[model samples]
Target: MNKVIEVQKLSISSSQGCIVEELSLSLEWGKPVTILGETGSGKSLLAQAIMGALPRGLEAKGEIRLLGKTVECKADIEELWGREVAMLPQEPWLSLDPIMPASKQISLVKRLVSLLNKPKSESIAIDSLARFGLEGSEGKVPSQLSGGMAQRLAYLCATSAGGRVLIADEPTKGLDSSRKQQLIQLLKEHSNKGALLTITHDVEVAKALGGEILVMKQGKVLETGCCESVLNAPKSEYARSLISARNLDHQRGDLLPNHKVLLELKGVEKSRGGKTLFSNVDLSLREGEVLGLVGDSGAGKSSLADVVLGLVQSDKGSVVHHQVLTRPKMLKLYQDPPASFCQSITLAKNLEDLCKLHQLDRKDIPRLMSELSLNSELLNRKPDSISGGELQRFAILRVLLMKPKVLVADEPTSRLDPIVAGSTIQLLLEQTSRINCAVVFISHDLELVKQVSHKVVKISDYVANHSSELSSPLVTV
Candidate 1:
């Protein structure tokens, strides 16, 4: 076996405390290593340390050997990027160049790193785009594409340089089932030629990648073994729960109580980047009702949400909200929880500001926190200091305090581990139910949508299909 990356006693700590503790592992050529963990388990930190890309405040202590070389600092590993190793960061959509066309981004990477001619680089870029079902999106910029489309482009660019070892951090965050499967397969094939290291919260991805597995929690490895053994017969409690969350079958049956309609979309039609995403769409969201929206990536799910929330105007439709619902009464839980919070300040400060602006009673905080299982001390920490799951809980808590009439959650739990995701969703359903709030839940996971929604809508049914030269359909997200 050819060993490419070796590590010993790797630890990452921040001013708050230890983030990743004394982790050790080895990666060999043509074999994949998958790290499965919750949001705050230090998975990303480990990958960053390996890449010498840890943030400024974070401190890392460890020994990393690559290609029989001893790298000492960021500069030591700088030259190795794209030549020896490459990485796909979390939420890759945000990392893509906003002004550059998708195909040009891929072609530029191939041209710069692979040293290919213009024609060949462009040809290969098109092929790579087709490989990930992103064909015909060549001319579109990142913002002009859907969340999943941008993520695919980012992966193509990251791997374009023929990096021998690929580190993907939550590579499948915004993807639907088909795209997630295609990506895992591509990563598998890449590992056949080089080595792949994937850090994810998705259990299905770990099961499908089938090589070595590491189950991490709060900066510690609790389980490690062959993928089949570790997943099929997981020994750790957390690991078992992670897998269980994926396998369970249940539903949030008929939570509606014939309440008044909170919002209505009549013959809605929307176009982005000179292309139609969906047309002639009609939907009604009622008080205390949960409407689940499911569709392929780039199928205008998020755009529909915006239309309902009045964030985006539909080209040929009317969105009428109940007179009782105002801007503050309508809330949106974002796909990325951290985006909803003010990163510079403490969580408590952010919540306090909201409370003071609305003249809310501070006593409501404790009751909501208790119901959501959120600790009071978390308020003292900054947004970046807490886990994504906790941050999302706090986001919900913030919304609950406002007593919203309608909650449009856009892929709210896509980035979370199955276990915490399950809990967070449960908290959402329970809290909204208590508030008698209407919900428009958008998700890529069919099972999750089925379990939690009162009725599910396939947005593709309303989409009007048209071909273009890299139409670059900006399905709203």
Candidate 2:
């Protein structure tokens, strides 16, 4: 293996605290390297540092060499970026220009492609989109595409840019199993041609890619070794815990106790403009059971969540809670942290406002902050200033403070690292247990669905197959 990227004594810090410290690693050409950590573990910071795009006020101290050539730490580094290395951010919407068509965004990367090879720009763009499963999606804008589609488009742009090094931050965050497999295959193909540095909490993805794996904790590298060695027999306790958590999530039947039905949806039908999204859908959730919802994008999984939260009116049917019906009083969290928060407001203030809206005391903020392991100092910082994982924790805190009888979380930890996702799930489950609240967790990650939920619902296929009898309970897994 030939080293394509090398980092020596890499350290990154922000006003809040150190993001990464003395992180030294290497990526070999035609090989895949994975960086694993929990939420708030600075994985994104590490990626940004490599691309010389760290946020303002953050400082870096390290040596980074690409193809044995040292990269200068100057403003011109942005010029070197995209050509030498391309990045796929966690949220594709953030990377894309909302006003521009998806095709134009692909065209914008033409300069970098031209730098590498003089292929027809339009042909290359079309080919790249096809490879990413976005064929014929060129006419759509970023806002028009679903979360999964936008993510795939972003991957296409980054990979098509002809960068020698590709850095992906949670590339598979919002994708379904089928699309996940496709993306993984695409990443494998890319790795066979160039070096890949994947930052993810997905152990399966890391294993499937099969390469070096680095585990980081609290801004430090805790373990680094072959993928199988680190995953199967981790040396560090933290690494072992991560593996254990993932295993537990996969083996839900063994870890969770089956209970009687706690909530039931009968003949749930929803539609818009006379086009049925989902109809006659019947589902039941039991106490202490995690029900995993799996389906393609625009598959009505989110619509189902909305109906449960009383946010959207269903055309017909009824939602019955075995205990008591709170209607809109149910606590709900969204997939994207930004969607659930005010970007201009400090985390603490946002939390406080949530409390106030619910007629709660301001004094409860500190206790909630401590419970979620959020730094109290972050209370004053705007939502945009915090890490994705931190924002997720804050969102969880806001919901917990409300102390609703039911928690309807829509892909709550989709953007977090595996460790952070596991931790967040564990925390939510523990809280649910303590409060004895019924939870409705909606996500596209099947593995996560199987791990957390007692029953699994295949929404898209179910609706398609049973349109005439949507009231009947579909296959129960």
Question: Backbone collision count in every prediction?
Answer: 0, 6
Candidate 1 lDDT, tens digit per residue, 288-323?
A: 888888889988888888888888889998987765
lDDT of 1: 0.80
lDDT of 2 at 374: 78
Q: Which candidate is the best by TM-score?
A: 1
- Worst 10 contiguous positions by lDDT, candidate 1: 468-477
Residues 1-477, model 2: lDDT tens digits: 388888899999877667788889999888799988777778888887777677788888889776666654546366556677778887675778778878767876785454533346666777777766677677778765656778888887776667777899998877888888888987888789888999888877888898999998888899999999999999999999876665354323322444556677788888643447677778776655556666786566777877776778778899887766565347678676676787777776777677767797777678767777778887788887777788878878778777766678878877676666766777887776566566777887665665676566767644534543222243234
In model 2, how large is the Cα lDDT of residue 130? 73
Alpha carbon deviation, residue 407, candidate 1 (Å)? 1.5
